[model samples]
Target chain A: MRGPLSKRLFLWTLVWAVVLTLSAPTFVIIGASLTAGEMLQFPPEGLSFKWYRQLWQLDDFKHALTRTFYVSLICTLLSLPVGTLAAIAMVRYRFRFQGTLQVYLLLPFTIPLVVSGLSMMLFFGDIRVLGQLWPVGVGLCAINIPFMIWSVSASVNALDPELENAAANCGAPPVQAFLTVTVPAVMPGIITGALLMFILAFNEFLVSLFLTDSRTVTLPVQIYNSIRSVITPDLAAVSVVFILIAVVTIGLLDRLVGLEIFLRSK
Target chain B: MNRTLNRKPIAWTLLDAVEISASTVWPFRGRAAVARAFLLPAVLVVGLLLVGLGYIIEYSFHELDITTYRLKDEYSIINYHTVLERPVYLRVLGRTVLASLIVTFLTITLALPYAYVLVRTASAAMRKFLLFALFLPFFIGQVVRAYGWLIILGREGLINAAVTSLGLPTLDLIYTYPAVLFGLIQYMLPFAVLLLIPAIAAIGEDMELASEGLGAHWVATFRYVVLPLAKPGLVGASVVVFTLTMTDFAMPEILGGGTNDFIASAIYDSFFQISNPGLGAALSVILIAVGSLLVMGFFLAAGPGTLGFRSRV
Candidate 1:
């Protein structure tokens, strides 16, 4: 409805405002991490890598970082195959209770993280499965599966079933057809789902809090405990690192497959 | 298409015949069993999760011995009574509901226009960029995002720094109700936008053009044509956002700074710090009940068919 120049300017202005607001915290954390002073001071007296150096010295942070990656990686690996199978079943099979099953699968996504964590704590803690890293990873996997299913299902739905039919018609077994035709066609969805699942598991906190033992504290849990006890530039340093990892991961995913399709599936 | 029998490859032909026979036979006998197998994991996980919730519901009605840190199986409504009797718990519940409602409203209000622009503008590049910007925070953990706001809203944080630099007196917005509200709004904004986009896109441009051509102003057209079509999305987004904010623990814990306590923090304290599982379970049951009632209200208002997309499938 407006001139192209004005429209372009409006779009740019809108975008810049959002980008600035969203990235403001990232900048502040980065700046605070580089402060020469002991406190979290932005626009510091001088830039220094002291906090980054000290971050390594803090064994809790170091351990938490390693544990976080381990748990996230394990969870992602477990959820990917399970989620892919579920997605295939949902897309390929026409059953009487298909819609109901789809809804049931999505229950974890609708429930709050705190509630889920609390429930897992109660269930696992009662069963003495608490304080185990695998159970924690499993709980996170449970949450991630639905999201993985949804994203992959979106891709699966987009795929032409006739390809699988054709493969089967051309003397391929059902399993062979799935491997040769279905998996390749849905690889984008699988990759997108895996990336999102990894990120979710990587950044998960509430579930980790309830399920993790001292031996398996994730980074977000570590940062949270640190923040509660003290206000230090080290927290900012860790936050800066977290933001960078998130940005890089998200940017890579956006480049690999369009972000919009993945997000809309959410 | 390869129905012709190849007698030369006898072994292979027999194997193929066996495979085809098994496949055909399995559909009637084992299809149900296979379907159940495919569904077993989801059912087990969800069933276990619900069982946990059921345990909470059961525990909420039980009596607790503070001295032993044990729950007495004898049924009692004492915990609910305790919650209702204390004005503090009731007040916190009220504040939690109010905060979530306000956050949901603010989220939809801000997101709707921005989403409208995204869909209506038809700028592929801008849409991609804005969509990416919107989803960027999903990458960041909620704890970190809340902590980011803690930095922004603190006394010496960015907001205060900017205000003081302008020679204006600093406002004590942090560690108060508004701080909690602000954090909730920020958290729920992306969800609201995501829900609205598809709904808006589904309406397409013809409706808007037709409304405008009929002498309707942009505002009128939006209220009349666009809003009605987007009601399902609006309802679904509101329910999700409201329930999320209502049960949120970390945001209020970090930003509320002891000035406010939502049901989630209250539940956390009872369950963890106080080691009162019965009381904690009671509080959780109450929270879930309230959340479910709101969801039910949405479903009733929107009617049954519209609740389909609310499943997030």
Candidate 2:
């Protein structure tokens, strides 16, 4: 408490040490991806962008990337409205069995991905909807809705209901008041929820593995299959890109809403 | 003023209509309609997942013909018995539980002092930077992070390189128990820090000062004062880390190197590789049961009305 300069220096050093330690892997992968020689040799001799270029050229990786983007995009879009509605209901309503409803809504988050994947596989297979892209989208949407609900609900709790009441009193319809007042008030929450849902869907693998056909194979699934079948610098290259996307997304979120609020809500 | 007056009457008419419909249609009608409209989508999704889970549970107890690759209508407990009686299944289950516990304990231990420092430090910039560093790894993709560890723990990777540079004999670590543990602990440490920071911040500096003024040693103050107050964060963080590690497939699959397997990976293999849906379903049920029990046990141990009780207060 007495010495400010030294304390700051010490704290900075500690932070730098931890960050450097954790970031070593990211650097190593990037270096390995750029290695001129094959076979993932580290200290990765004579760097080049050959592997990265090679990975980009692969049709499967390209298709998987596109599929992953589309699926995550669709899931995020579908989940936002649904999750926002659920959050509003949970926060605004005080009905019987509301607590029970909240628990049920959170059940998807509690269930393991493997179980969810397997269950979806069986259920969809029985209904003849297995091996379709829509089911894969639905599975991702189901898994992501709870996360969106929680985040949006936290923000919803912070909103003042008086604005909506004022609008309604001023000759606005209920839907119009909600659209003009509540929705704008909760936009930050909705954005955060959408970001989370997108990331979850993008990174999802187990569910994709069960629910996706060839037409719907996601990037994570493709990388997973590649890793199992063959060890290549291309997979490492693809992982580098994936990590970059995640890092950029998080950095953007930190800039937009602050990291503390996001973590605190969780 | 005239336009406003005209719109007001129209809006009033709409409200009157809504009121008439609400009163005539049913009791608590307006609220019921609003609630239903809001709750319908969430309830439908939850219902779908529950139905799927219900089917999985039903399938778990039935017999599937190996030759036909079809489910037999006749019910049997053979899958559950097989899971219970087999040494492999039992060993994997025990190991998964043990590994998760170890990882959770390690994460809490490593994160506690770090979180304490982050929250108690006076400098605003330092706190921001520290928190950012802590959350950075979490934002990165899990598979990429796991692969990062694979490189670090590999035969000629960074750890071994450092050891040889220091003139020490290289230790074989990758694909071993230590690798798995290290990967899991690193993966979960950020979560522990995130959870602990708020609780630590909530304690403030006055309590620590008071304890020290009362001549309590640092260790005594931390054990008796800080920890008890931080119990909620500890419980929440531990519950999350334990459950995630318990159900995790990628970490154990990549690091365990055929020498180890968690129940998640086993379930994956049964369903996809072996095509034994019944056995897979049984494994899944067991996994869920174990995870739920662990969470419940943590809550009970932490006491009623504490953290880990429920998401909401």
Per-residue CA lDDT of candidate 2, range B1-313, in tens?
5677556577657766775575566455466678777889878876767878988899898877978997788999999998998899999999999999899998788777777777676777876777666655666656777777776787776688778888999878888887888878877888778777656766757887798789986667788898988887888778878888888887787777767888898998887788888999999998888788877787678742212212334
Model 2, stretches more than 4 Å misplaced?
A1-21, A166-172, A263-266, B1-32, B161-170, B303-313
- Where in model 1 is the C-alpha error above 4 Å? A1-19, A262-266, B1-34, B165-169, B303-313
Residue range A161-240, candidate 2, lDDT tens digits? 78778988998766567767898898878888888888878888778888887777888877766665545677789988
What number of clashing residue pairs does each candidate have, in the order they appear?
A: 0, 0
- When superposed on Cα atoms, how far off is each prediction in RMSD? 4.5, 4.0
DockQ for each numbered candidate: 0.35, 0.39
True-vs-predicted CA distance for residue A15, candidate 2, Å:
6.1
Residue range with the least summed lDDT across 10 consecutive positions in model 1 chain A = A1-10
B1-313 per-residue lDDT for model 1 (tens digits): 4656534477556656766886886664534565665567656766667767777778788888867779886999999999888898999999999998799988888777667676766567877777767767767877888788877778877778888988999878788988888878777877777767766766767887888788986667778998998886787678778888898887888888877989888888988888877888888888877887777777777843222422234
Residues A1-266, candidate 1: write the lDDT tens digits.
32246544654575465556666566677778888998765557699999899988988887888888888888888787778877777766767888788767877766666777888878888898888777777788886687788667778877887888888799987545666788999888888888888888989887888888677788998888877876778888898778887888778787888776633422
